[model samples]
Target: MPVYDQERAGGHPGRPLIQNQTVRIVVIYAIFGLAWIYGSDHIIDLLIDDKGMLLQIAVAKGFVFILCTATLLYILINRLLGQLAAADRGRLENLENLSQKNAQLRLFFESAPASLAMFDRDMRYMEVSRRWLSMYGLGERDIIGLSHYEVFPEIPEYWKECHRRGLAGETLREEAEEFRRADGSLQYVRWEIRPWYQAAGEVGGIVIFTEDITERKRFETALEANERFLRLLTDHLPGLVGYWNGDLTCGFANRPYRDWFGKNNDEIIGSTMRALLGEELFLQNEPHVRAVLAGEPQHFQRTLVKRDGETAYVWSHYIPDLVEGSVHGFYVLVSDVTELKRAETERQRLEHQLQQAQKMESVGRLAGGIAHDFNNLLTVIMGLAQLGMRELGAGHPTLVRLEGIQHAAEKSAALTSQLLGFARKQTIAPRALNLNGAVEEMLKMLKRLVGEDIDLAWNPGRDLWKVCMDPSQLDQILANLCVNARDAITDIGKITIETGNVSFDAEYCNAHFDFVPGEYVLLAVSDDGCGMDRETMAQIFEPFFSTKEIGRGTGLGLATVYGIVKQNNGFINTYSELGEGTTFKIYLPRHTEEGARPLPEAAPAPCHGGSETILLVEDEASILNVAVSLLTLQGYQVLPAAKPGDALELAQQHRDRIDLVITDVVMPDMNGRELVRRLLPFCPKVKCLYMSGYTANVIAHHGVLDQGVNFISKPFTMNDLAAKVRAVLDAKGEAVD
Candidate 1:
């Protein structure tokens, strides 16, 4: 039936050798028997003498021959028996070894972890392992002797072909298939079908080894779905997110990372960190990267310059990817904080500005108080000196000394005026005036002031907006700014004066606290000269805070400009860099109106005596005495009082008409405006001239002269008093109300 059985049954080398030995033995035995028979007969014939004796002798000899022949046959039979017994013992030993090997193979097949089975060439199961029966939900008795298709009728043709191939001497391994069992359960099986050969090299059967891989396949599917979800999450995040491997090569990058770096996913993935970030950036970040890879988390801020040369602030965090208590790689998260940083910077700037403003306000109040007290004393001193000068005629020797005293007092008064300006207490008379025309008029004076070496560049805007500010105040602003510009330049440089119409919006005003939203007249004075540092700029508007050498400056120039601008409801901004240049831009609210022709310049006021009856009220005794004497000498009837109550008494006693009342604005008994209000009930027809060392809110509103109110600043000489008194008496307007 089988090639191996046929070979063993006929003409085998060992069988032929055994046959030859048996034939030889048979021939030898036959020869020995023949010789014994013939030889014994001849011996019997020779040994016998008489017939009777010969018969007896022949019988004995024949018996002996027969015994010898029997002995030889017994020997041959014993040899044959011994040979057969040894052969039988060897055969029994071989059979016992084969049986032991078969038992071992059966144990191995049943104990296998994988489902293993053996089938004949006919595809019938020869044997099945316990694992195979368990895996396929079958019993060994049910599967053995059954064909594969018979055991599972739903087996696909591909699998059947695989079985056929195995039986045809082919070996198949690791073919995965979804196998449906008879019980209606499905299994993902990866199996190996190998043809097992007999000793003669012919395919006798096949051994199929199967593994259930359903769980493994399901796990792979879940893993893929999770990966896709993770990718989607990272891609949609606003921050730049990425993962790096142990080699510092990028394993994955989010959409932001790719877009920000101006690269695609394919270019970023698998690229080294150093390669993706240029060498400079890589070097900057190398330490952080190393630290993260060393299992330490890192967070820091960096400034990135974009392709358009714009700067951006980024906050980055590098978190190490820890696996099994060791570092595998790191994760990167980057967020743009440029706007946040800018807002913070702006906040700091505004805070500094507010502090400076508060400081200036405090200092200004102190300066104003000092100036007010000093002005009061100077008023008494100057008033007495003027009286002395008038009494001592031009021919008198002491008249020259009185004039000197008068000049010194006048200089002190000028200093006080500067203080008032810095304090924003000086009265201003505003009129709508074109700035361009004003600048043009100042061009000549500026040229002479800055000297020939310094170039003057004046670019005045056409159709400039009219500014409602005191013309004298404008002159002071321009003069002081030009002088400062001149002093800043150590060598030949240029001074530029530019005028333009500009507007500030709400956003700009929000950033700069002092700014307001309106159309403005922009006056910018620029100089290519030595600039101030931050410390100097911070104190620039403070009174007597000068950078110049001692005695070279009073430091009130810029302070006065600051006061004037603020009083006019304007803002000033400065831009400067050390050793580069400086620019001061003043923004004054524009006055919207049709341009008017310039007014005719009026001749200077002539000092003259006023004959009108006047009430003079002064808190200081010296000022009171001097003013009464000065007016008495000028042929005017003067009622003098040291306080408001005394003045009220004098006014009531004087039944005659008192043409005017000259009262100190700040007095101990009462303020001038209140005194005026009270005195007005007594003498309703009396006009009042309010005088103060410094302008006060009683007589003025926001350092501006109230309309129809007559006022004068103190520290006046006889000439100033004479001119003001005459002008007030001659005025053809309604009496002070």
Candidate 2:
């Protein structure tokens, strides 16, 4: 360390520090020679003897000094060489460190994501990143150590000025800039320019960072366009549309939302649901709002009383706006469905009516079948009892008992008749009659049925039109209606029977189900009794359907009336409400054509024996036996046939004329019509008399008797049978009416 400063700073002169270094070396050599010559000679003399040996000693002394001087110079040179070697090592280490730091900086600039380039003070490229080369489309060329202006000659002078300013230690940057490439394509760029410094703290070069942002800009433009289109679409929609935040604050509203809430978008936006919809509506919607916010979508219907005082039906949907599996907000859609709701209700009502009609029709059919079977049994009972009474005479002890049996059978026959009426299969002997006369004829009977306290008033319309309905059916309608009215009353109430004329058009019938278009005679029965509700009225005419306790009613009164009206090609309608009175109006088609009038009231004619040959056909053996006995007792010679084929055989075999043919309408082998048709050839002038437990005759369709046919209902007494047979045989003019 001590020789280092001297060797380097001219303190020692081995390396020849100045131009006079050789003179210095020579002077040092002269001093060293004098010292060596003088010191060594004295020492040698002191250590040796004799003037004669002086020349030898002097030669040895000179050699010894030379050797010592050479040795001393070698030591100084070695020390200097050691110090120089240390200095050289330090310089090499510093250079290696600088070189290493420079390589690392070049590497950092090469692979950086940013399009970066490093330049020297003269604006020449020192280093460039791969990204910079790629962005500029210059990856293939080696542009290092080249001037920036030469590499990009197409760049604007303004950019060059920016580079110059950066090299002058100024920092410059651009957030966005438009540039055209060499291919005449436009591109957006973001860049930064700044200077780098050297170890001397002076600006070494300008570094530039560039980014290609064309794709990002394009994406932003598309997003803005989509937002505008969404707004336009939502505004044109029919439903009320809007978006709500998690806190129920309105974020957006479409055009219809303004009409729905009676508020514009400016007023509605940012408003809470409760504040906008009011307390009542908000409470109704609160549950759905919370659900949607909890990420559950909601759909429901509501009837709202709007601000205009009119009501509206709305179907609404609330969809959750889920982002990353969490509910951020919700979307709302509400549509008016007022008309649709009304139509749905009407459709349901019509469907119910159709189902009710189908049910009634089925009940009618069932009741008809039951009535037919029961009437056959009743015929045998009543016929046998009457036969017994005639044989025993009135004075016999068993005569009263036989009469009682006959009366009971008659009552059962009446009940079966009611069933047949409800089924619309009653044996109706229709007569063209005025409604006033029919109501008047039954008024006294109705009064007796209702009792004295319940006044049965007859309000007959003046000069009412005639209706071609059976008189018995009219009697039933009035009797059943008055009885029902009497039962309904807890206290004194009035039962009114009104007769009037009514006409229905096609339009009216269309509106009212089961009504047909025609002019009709209206026979209405009204009562001031406890009225029925709509539900009870709906089932009032169904067989076995009654409101009264089990025994109070047989439940067939109104059903019978319904069947009677329908069978006569008419319709019935009733109106009633709870706490109000009930009114039943029956419309019978007006009888414009010629029709038979009901026979006048007369005494029963004395029974007389018939001499006419008769054909009696019956399916039931007992009824057939009874009918044959009855006819035989009346002195008519009868040919009995169980089947229709037997009746044909009997007619064909017997050559004598069959004055009359009494055949049951429904038979096993064939119906009475076919039997009569085939038998007509054998007995060409035979008088036909049809009998049936069924009200509707096989010879007549739907209870309209065929022309030139005589008909009688079954369950007849001996007297009734004798009277009908004699009448048919004696008809000499036209066929029995």
> Pick by lDDT: which candidate is best?
1
Q: What's the lDDT for residue 352 in model 2?
A: 81
How well does candidate 2 score on lDDT at residue 466?
88
Expressed as tens digits, the lDDT of each residue in 60-93 for candidate 2 is: 8778877977886676556556655665665466
Model 1: per-residue Cα lDDT over 1-737, one tens digit each: 11222334453324554676578667876786677667766775786556887778667867876797678668866776676677667656655766676676778787776778888888888777888888877754576788888877878788889898988988788746777867778778888988888877788888889988888878877999998898899889878899999998999898888888888988989999888888999999999989998999999999998767799999999999999989999999999888889999979977976787788788778878888898888889889989998888789999888888889988887777777789898656788989888888989998999899888887787778789987878878888898898999987877878787665555335545677766778888877678788878988987677999999899889989998899898988876657646778888988755575644432324567867899999997876877787678778999898999998888788735789999986666677877877887678888878876442221242223364578764444455577778888888867786
lDDT of 1 at 298: 98
Off by over 4 Å in 1: 1-242, 250-316, 324-326, 334-359, 380-415, 429-445, 457-468, 484-493, 496-562, 570-737
**Residue 147 Cα positional deviation in candidate 1, in Å, after optimal superposition:** 36
What C-alpha lDDT values do all the predictions have?
0.79, 0.78
Global fold similarity of model 1 (TM-score) = 0.38
Q: What are the TM-scores, per candidate, against the unseen true structure?
A: 0.38, 0.39
Residue pairs that clash (backbone atoms under 3 angstroms), model 2: none
Per-prediction RMSD in angstroms? Answer: 29.8, 32.7
